[model samples]
Target: MILVIDNYDSFTFNLVQYLGELRSDIHVVKNDELSFAEVEALHPTHMVISPGPGLPQKAGMSLKLIEHFYQKFPILGVCLGHQAMAMVFGGSLKQAPTLFHGKTSRIYHEGKGILKNVENPFCAMRYHSWIIDHEKPIHSDIETIAYTEDNIPMAIQHKKYFVFGVQFHPESILTPEGKKILKNFLEISYDKAHPLH
Candidate 1:
């Protein structure tokens, strides 16, 4: 089963719809509503942290979930979820030089992990005021995999775990390759969950 942690974002359902294409067992819970013990009972094979308003510090259960399952299962964080993932591992966030809400930007990526087989400089939909600070030193375990034309960190993955984050919203119709990007993540999660398969 795939567990989606909703941060009260309007786009959460859109993300969930994409996930449903690849997996039938998906569950979404509000960030502030679920307890860790309750989450554990669901036995989620993979987790996705949805984008939303506010800072990572105030993301509630989403932050705690990453800290707990980053090593145990695969995680994909988008926008606010992306910020929370970085902050959990010593990365910092700052207000973007230009706020991008319901906008599109070109993303240059290393074509690794979730970005594997994706276009190197694909256009993606963006909607956020803050981003992972590029000027500061990122955590040793976190390897930046993608950046925008403006040099903002757009995607990241943990060095030794199946955790990943993308500043762009793959669920948005504005992103032409949204489904492909999400499909890659589901494949990664499946491979990690069933190593022998």
Candidate 2:
């Protein structure tokens, strides 16, 4: 089963619907209800940190849950989730020079990992004021894989794990290749769940 931690974003249902289209075994739980024990009880095959409001640092418990469970399965972080991943890994987040809310922006990515089959310079939906600081990567295990035209970290992936984060909301219809990106992540989770098959 796939578990999504809803951070009370307006688009939480959109992500849930998108994942449901990919697989019927998708579940969503509020951020306040998140706990390592509860997550373990559900036995989710994969976990997705949904886009949310406020700073990632404020979601202290959720970050800890990610840190504890990330190594157990393939995890994907979206927007706020991306920032949460960075903070959990020792990276920092700060206000963007310009905040983006419901805007389409061109993202230049190297087509690596989650962006593997995605087209270069893809147009993705942007909706956040905070970004992961690229100048200083506090976590040696994390690597920024994509950036915006202005040089903000657009996408990031773990150096040696099936974990990734996208600053943009891939579940939005506004994103040119949103579904494809989610599909790629679903495949990753499948591979990990059915390893050696």
Candidate 3:
């Protein structure tokens, strides 16, 4: 199960529909109305935070909730979600190098397993003005997974937790191997479903 937290009608609606096509068992909550009480009650297997229009300071600003759940479950943060994750984890965000309102942007940095095999790391639909920039002294556990030519925090993973984030919306059409990335996330949470020794 995946609890998608956000306030966008298009991204939420499209994600709900897209995940259905990608996998039969995948479940998503289409609204950001998930109260801490609500999320605690449900105890979903995975959580994916979707993108929104405005900056984090002006947007929903659910940092406490983001922090709470991130400690409890594996999370995949997209665009705005990515920024939110960085902020809550002691990172900062600022306006992008330029207003990149396009269908794709190249991730020129190196990556590992989840991002492997993609010819280009271009996400399909993104409309944001801000990007994440980690603080000088970042948490040691967090490893940067993706970045642009100028080196923005495109994706990151904690060494100890199942938590992961991407500054781009992999569910969108422009991402060449988007589904595979999601598959990697699903696989991470799968371990929780069946713990090993």
Model 1: per-residue Cα lDDT over 1-197, one tens digit each: 89999999999999999889888999999998998898889988889999999998888788889998887778999999999999889899999999999999999988788888788789999999999987888789798899987789999988778889999999998888789988887777545453311
lDDT of 3: 0.67
Error of 3 at 82 (Å): 0.3
Best of the candidates, lDDT: 1
lDDT of each: 0.88, 0.85, 0.67
Ten-residue stretch with the least lDDT total in model 1:
188-197
Stretches of candidate 3 off by over 4 Å are 25-32, 116-125, 134-137, 190-197
Q: Which stretches of candidate 1 lie over 4 Å from their true place?
A: 190-197
Order the candidates by lDDT, highest first.
1, 2, 3
**Which candidate achieves the best TM-score against the true structure?**
1
Candidate 2 clash pair list: none
Superposed Cα deviation of residue 1, candidate 2 (Å): 0.4
User: Model 3 TM-score?
Assistant: 0.82
List pairs with backbone clashes in candidate 3: 124-174
Ranking under TM-score, best-scoring first?
Answer: 1, 2, 3
